[model samples]
Target: MPDPQSLDECVSIQQWLQREHLPLASPRPPAAVHVSLYCVGKSARIPEGVIAAARQAGTAIEACQFELVFDHIITFLLPQDNAIVLAGNGGRELWQLHVQIAIEMHRLGADANLNPNFQPHTTLLYDKDVVPRIALRRPVVLAAREFVLLHNRRGQADYEELGRWPLHARG
Candidate 1:
């Protein structure tokens, strides 16, 4: 998850899109803005043991804080709706951290289906209308100081934070 300032910046971008008369769907709360690392499973299917394992996996990860630079806003076409997002490369450190987390999860007997082609992004809103990619005037840089494990119910806006772990400062 991003820091409070970054979350505010994301919300500001969403507000900008709304002002442009873009066909935006629901606006996500600032607290809900996040770059998803792994999806365990559905809310009902995820057992307490799995959650514990996930938490343990998080604790096992050894990584330094990194920055994520979102340079463009793009739309991903989905069957239900188009997801408008702030897209970024998220650099090598982020990828390494992601892989480390996945490795730890697997070691702890948890299913962390790591995707080879993972694109880091933060979804701003959803819409039926597709929009062309727009480069930001200034790239939004988010300091990824910490990561959280969340339990999000489908079709709901609220996110239940299961656990949080801080990335240590680089030496």
Candidate 2:
């Protein structure tokens, strides 16, 4: 089989489908890449003030216009539950950091369901089946300053920045 990590060649037929352009998908944004950080739960709604703060921070710090997208619904295990989302050998390390942030967010009382153990990911393409599992390292670096709140629609969750904080090298 072809190496999945290889950048020069297609890893498999599945990877090709993932890359193919889709009509229903949101067009990629120019500023920060859109990524899912945590699940805040149905009951835990983002306060309007928090959303305002994040919007201000995102534009002020990043120097770009920000908008929210209610595009996808995803799931991931948390470390608190003795379950972790690992990005396999070929998985991205950023994802690991996201999980850590989720745990921290949970500790801060954002919402039990949405806090720690957030499985970070972005909606690239839609699919009906469960996502393939991958290995990843723990305690990845993430910025606490940058976060958005999104509204839930059906099973799909939309994302919007709720607040922004600077991430130091230590975090």
Candidate 3:
């Protein structure tokens, strides 16, 4: 997630969407906006080696602070799952981070359901059937010094920050 100010803005957007009768995945705004780099399921299945590798990779990167520009919303109307998300500006650093995380996961044998075509986005809602009508808002820049290893608390959407790795390390 980004700084408090940016997150507040995201909350406002969610509120607007909800009031307009757009199907929302949850009631709380704190759980709405976030940039998920990897979705490794089942913490029990996540090998210790993978976690080690992720930590090593995290330590290797000096560019920890992130500033992402988001402007548009995308809707996936697939049969199994449907979601609306705010797409990022295709930042190279962000993609590199995802690649590093994925590599570790694959090395540790936690590669199941690792999305190769991972696009960095903050999901606003996951609704079925109804195609939400949303316009392109002005670009919002979200900045954060750290990225979180968020684990699902009680299934999808509801999450708790498990581990946090700082970015922009000089070492």
Candidate 4:
């Protein structure tokens, strides 16, 4: 562990994981590279006001915020493919709050799709023959103040983020 960046060091760690019999997921495909505004909760129907807020927010960010470019693919297991319509980095506290919000929205019959355990990630590559061979290094904080509502295609369909909104500011 003294010099963790060496190739030998990296191979040793990979060997350890193999010896431990941990299940590693298959790598994703390169064609899957995409940008998205992950779905949030399903409220029987989206509220007109919420949709308006999202559109306004998208316009604001596009005008003022620097667009972020990413090279990762991520997935969150949800019951339905298109339930939630927004995604954001809530930090620890805000993420917790986001989950609670989804739960509450569900309890109130909001039809929102809530991830059981939401861990935000950006994918870098999809492996076709073998699973990715590297562990993720935590990324530096980036500007992501809002999540967007994406038009849901089928489970295997390509989703596009239509609009975004600012994260409710932390008090």
lDDT of each: 0.85, 0.35, 0.66, 0.38
State which candidate, 3 or 4, has the greater lDDT: 3
Report the lDDT tens digits of candidate 3 across residue range 60-87.
5555566788777677665755666767
- What is the TM-score of each predicted model, taking all chains together? 0.92, 0.35, 0.75, 0.39
lDDT of 2 by residue, 54-135 (tens): 3443343321222222222222433322111212221333444344544444455443343333344443334333444432
Task: Name the TM-score of candidate 1.
Answer: 0.92
Question: For candidate 4, what's the RMSD?
Answer: 10.9
Q: lDDT value for candidate 1? A: 0.85
Report the lDDT of model 3 for residue 147: 78
Off by over 4 Å in 1: 42-44
lDDT of 1 by residue, 1-171 (tens): 877788888999998886784744766777788987777676565898888988998888888988899999888889987888999888998889878888888898888778798889998888888778989998899998988999987777878898999999988
Query: For model 2, what is the alpha-carbon lDDT of residue 113?
Result: 42
RMSD of 3: 3.5
Per-residue lDDT, model 3, residue 28, is 41
Instruction: Provide the lowest-lDDT 10-residue window in model 4.
Output: 81-90
Stretches of candidate 3 off by over 4 Å are: 21-28, 42-62, 78-81, 107-109, 112-114, 130-135, 155-157, 169-171
Which one wins on lDDT? 1
